[model samples]
Target: MQFFKQIKSILAVSLVLLFMAAPAIAGQPKYVFYFIGDGLGAAQRQFSEFFLQDQLKNPNSQLVMDTFEVAGINTTYCADTLITDSAAAATALASGVKTNKGVIGKDVNGNNVKTLVEEARDHGMKTGLITTTRLTHATPAAFASHNISRNNENEIADDFLNSGVDFFAGGGIRHFIPASMKIENADALGKTIKSKRKDEKDLVKGFEGKGYSTFIGMKGAKAFKSTDFSKQDKVFAAFTYTHMPYEVERMNQYKNVPSIADMTRAGIDVLAQGDKGFFLMIEGGRIDHAAHANDPSGVIWDTIAFDDAIKTAYEFFQNHKDQTLIVVVGDHETGGMGLGMDSMGYKLNMAALNDVHVSVEDTLNDGAGQYKGDKAAYLSYLSKNFGLSNLSDAEAASLNKAMVSADAGETLGYYKLNPAALTAAHILSTRANINWTTTIHTATMIPMSATGAYAGRFGGYKDNTQIAKAMAQTLGFTL
Candidate 1:
């Protein structure tokens, strides 16, 4: 009887150990959603959270990304520079290798490096790349194409034809068409598609020949949903001629263009149809653009829009918790943005930003030219559009100085911002107590957060290259 009792105890211990090890034995995740917020840093994200809380009048409001279990800080320096550009930063995040600035999916010696997308495809998984910028841009191109320079959009566009990626979305239609071809009547935005390619080869037709069902502009995005892709799973979609409009601009005018969240949902629905699983990369590309312009409202709104896209992935994760992994990270920090300014004396009035209804880009494009020379008219325009009504004598003088320069068609600052637009944007940002150190990329650390299968692998402080390394390990492959 004693011997039998000991045998039963041993059996119970064995069963407990087996159950605990079950998840490890389950192999790689079936679905992976990789989200990259271009130029998103700690302050950029915090400002968005603060903006939302103020907008909702709830102090306890939090971003969905802040609620993730696995969170860490990621260094963003490149191999050759302290401050990394989008191309080199993206290559490190996608290939687990750091290259010099301006290089994409290639080493310092110009040798091609295999990216995570290539590994996913090798493992019999479907891949998709979606971004608010052109698909041929640095972030997306780093994953699927190899080139010596990120500026070679024509070469990057050609790479998509044979990348074996099942789905493609966002802008860059110009690079695909021939220089002499005019494609306006067929474009959904009713804008002419002029080619940037030096060759006469029409790449859109090339994509079509490779068994891809291509869609163009807002109309194309809507048609992408209704069409049946069960027979042909490959798809290519371009929603604009260049980068997608900033969130503020889109909300006020381009209502037909799809949001980043819209594209994320669409990419998931189409890519998830396969049985072997899928890898989808979604980039909020214009946060970098807005930050480079020192437009606080533009950055806040676009980051909010990016988080909405993450919510879409989080919802999908909820249903497939055991088989899905969602990772959210920023390629690098832009603008050196901060929450407090010296004049604010430790106070940040996020609520003040609510008075401003438009972005700096729109203000310059639509209104600045109309009220340039007249002091009263320009001040009135500032009050109506940028929410600056009662300016002190010095503030008014500063704005007047900018107006004179703008009227003479001058572009000022390091990023060559319109003088009037830059002045108005700075004043608006000051009202909210936000400060920017520079209108360029900063070597600051960005945030990385994840959830679901093997999400714990990404926790703790790490370099940007480790991101791809961790993903490869989670997927049971080598980067």
Candidate 2:
């Protein structure tokens, strides 16, 4: 009897010890915020930080991402190449598997791989996707769609509607509307028109049929802000027919469009109501677009906009510190961006970027053609928008040449910059001490940061696939 009592006592002490050690094990997070900055890398992040310091005149100013407790360097190579496009990089980050270029949520052999978002749905957790790009764009599409080709956006849109995500906000409504249903917008002064879908399926109506609260365009999104998100089981908000306007252009031209931060907040508000927790992915997609154009001003503003979304997610983390996990990462780097040039040596005047008022895209579309025949008007516009002053004789000659070439109906490659816009960008970049090696994607390692519950899982050097795996593990799912 004494021996049996001793055995029971040992068992009781062991149980007590186990209970005491329980707090050391990290519990599964109730909420996860995955922030993907497409085409953002170390240089891009540093450039944004420098810009903020220069703009705010606060050397101590820091981005919200800088506050994360754990940091990692992520290798962004896809299965097929050292350099990865948004589709393949997003696939690796979402599905814990490397995929070929232009693929979405599939391996090299064309096998469908379930994404972290899908895992969340299977676990009964609410899922949300928010992006500055279209909802069917590469980064967000990888989370919800399984397609052999990323270019099949119409099919991707169909996948998104049936993916069971609770909230989605972005652009690309054209994929949902049939071409026959497209109409000229009188409100846009006939300058803008609706996109036509080939399949003629009304996806907005389809979403409504499935009990989703749908919001389209600026007006619809504004109306959504006034609705009770808690009462809505699912919500979809798309602000543009394609990708949202670049941040610089949006601020100057499209005031009605919602910011990425705004969309993220709305996503959290709606998804947080789920009983089984939630997973949300917010993408600052225009950073990639601007980088692809090799436009420093556009890239800086978009990075700041992305940082604003990070701040929003951080605020939510402050309240649910123990139950939330927030991770910020970039799919890949574009534009081989660097801060210093041979002419500038080591000195960088980031404040010179403030002179840029519009994106290269905006300059090409709006200003270049308007000034094609008028030299004086063109120079004055450059002075006002690009802050170029006291142009040398050679510079003036080059500008005139560009304008003359543009007037002669010269066209460059699809990805090449407009001659007039390129001149302006070169002047601004020279002043800002920013240089770009290529306009295409680079085989660079991107930075990742994490905070809140189980953030340590993301620390150290990791492959992009490991990010998805860590997220899965944190959510108690097997990748």
Clashes of each: 0, 3
Indicate the worst ten consecutive residues by lDDT in candidate 1.
362-371
What are the per-residue Cα lDDT tens digits for candidate 2 across 1-479?
Answer: 99999999999999999987653235779999999999999989998998898888898998999778899999999988999999999999999999999999999999999899998999889999999988899999999999999999999999988999889998887887766765554111122336656766888888898888888775675676577777778998876767787888777776666788888888888999998789999999999988877778888899999999999989988899999999999999998888899878888988677766677765644544345677788788777776777787877888888788778877433475666767666667777888887778999999999999999999999999999988888777766
Would you list the clashing residue pairs of candidate 2? 178-197, 179-196, 179-197
lDDT of 2: 0.84
Error of 1 at 78 (Å): 0.7
Error of 2 at 42 (Å): 1.0
- Candidate 1 has a TM-score of 0.90
lDDT of 1 by residue, 1-101 (tens): 99999999999999999887663336569999999999999999999999999999999998898889999999999989999999999999999999999
lDDT scores in order? 0.86, 0.84
Mark the regions of model 2 whose C-alpha exceeds 4 Å error after superposition.
1-26, 186-193, 365-375, 404-414
Model 2, backbone clash pairs (residues 3+ apart or across chains), number: 3
RMSD of 2: 4.1
After superposition on all C-alphas, the RMSD of every candidate to the true structure, in Å, is: 5.7, 4.1
